[model samples]
Target: MKKNYGYARVSSKEQNLDRQIEALTNYGINERDIITDKQSGKDFNRTGYVTLKNQLLRSGDTLVIKELDRLGRNMDMIKKEWQELQENRINIIVLDTPLLNTEGKSDLEKKLISNIVFELLSYMAEKERIKIKERQAEGIKKAKEKGKHLGRPKAKYPKLWEMYYFQWKSGQITAKECMEQLDLKRTTFYKLAKDYESKLIK
Candidate 1:
């Protein structure tokens, strides 16, 4: 018998899987057949997804997902996986995009149309990602122009920084001892020392 399976994913452990689970269940997939992963969709190497693709799913089986992004965030990877599934003769049903469903697409013309649509969607997705990154870069540039600090705030210098720095510079204290006194790592201590010296020079 042809089995129906559902796959769902969340980007992080903090996100709940309840909505995906409910959607799959409502679509008539058995709760047991609904596989889920609490990990980013950046790749298809997710534990749940890998297990389902390699072991559970078979030819003639139907695989349902809430959306294309649920499968993966990488457009190229998503296209590759989709082609592999097609070669395996697995029917894919994307609930959010009905046109992507391949259940009733048996004719040559229909298949051609589906392929064209899939390629267009994949291209659009990739383009959208690029646009988002461009927007973020522009925003950062604007923020910098306005003198707004970017990235994590610099750590404050330790209370005994002046004393420890002078001792370290004068060779009276070892670098290790200075770091221990400031309760800082080697990198942080050196960074602070460099910044302090730069300020003194000014």
Candidate 2:
């Protein structure tokens, strides 16, 4: 017999899944059939989702999610999983997007709906990536204005850095010669020189 199952997800344990759970239950799905995970939507390595897909769902079963993003935020993975489910003859019902519900739909209707959903999801995922990049760039700019160092903390200079740095600065030794003596990379040697100068300014 065909069955209905629900899946819920939250990025963190602290995030509430009540709304999703409620929606699934309101859709008349039993609580026991609902699988949930509290982890990232970055990838689908989630325990609940994996178990549900691998162990529980069978051909003719319907999977329910409150929102498309509850399935995943990764557009590529989402499409991949959707294709797999379709190949397995399982159905999907996205509660928030009524038109995306596949239960009781004919093959032609399902294909049309899937295409629309895929296009919409792709658009959303791209916009999300751009917004995240913009926010990160803004944050970096603010941090720089505040004189905060970003990314990895600087490595401590080699034991001979001070001596080599002075020799290099005074033209007593070439930059390459100083780096070879101090066992520093080209970039690290220059960065150390800049830091030493900053310390002198302080």
Candidate 3:
């Protein structure tokens, strides 16, 4: 008998896998036959999906997915994976769009339709990624313009700045001595001192 397997994925940890499970169950796939990944669908590095592919796949096997996007966000990677499964004689069943079944079509028709869907998905995923990058860049630019510090928590020692200035002016005291007096590590001492120096220059 041919083994039937189901795959489900979510983009984030905050999303629940229950809905997908329920959908798969309603579709007549058993609980044990469905492998779920509660992780971003960006890559095929999913352990659950990999394990399912390895153990459940054989010639004439059927693999079901909730949707094409759930397989991967990258269109090229998804196409490559789909081809690999087909080469192994595994049929793909996409439940959301029942007509997308690779087994239900001729080889040429399957390639053409799958290619169109792949292009559309890849474009969408790439667009989303670009938008995110642009938003992040705009936020960072605005923060810089407003003089907001970019990263790391600000130093806790206001007094250290004053002590550093005084000790530095006393030519005899070294930076190490000033740091010791301020009870700060080299990094913290230097960071505050640099910020203070920048203020003086302004």
**lDDT, candidate 2, at 184:** 82
Sorted by lDDT, highest first, which candidate order results?
2, 1, 3
Q: Which stretches of candidate 1 lie over 4 Å from their true place?
A: 41-44, 107-110, 133-137, 144-202
Candidate 2 worst ten-residue window by lDDT: 37-46
* Decoy 3 TM-score against native: 0.64
The candidate, 2 or 3, that scores higher on lDDT is: 2
| Each candidate: RMSD | 6.2, 5.4, 4.7
Number of backbone collisions per candidate, in order? Answer: 0, 0, 0
My TM-score estimates for the predictions, one after another, are 0.65, 0.69, 0.64
Candidate 3's displacement at residue 120, Å, is: 3.2
Top-scoring candidate (TM-score): 2
Query: lDDT of candidate 1 vs native?
Result: 0.85
Sort the predicted structures by TM-score, highest score first: 2, 1, 3
Model 2, residue 55: displacement in angstroms?
2.4
Residue 160, candidate 2: alpha-carbon lDDT: 70
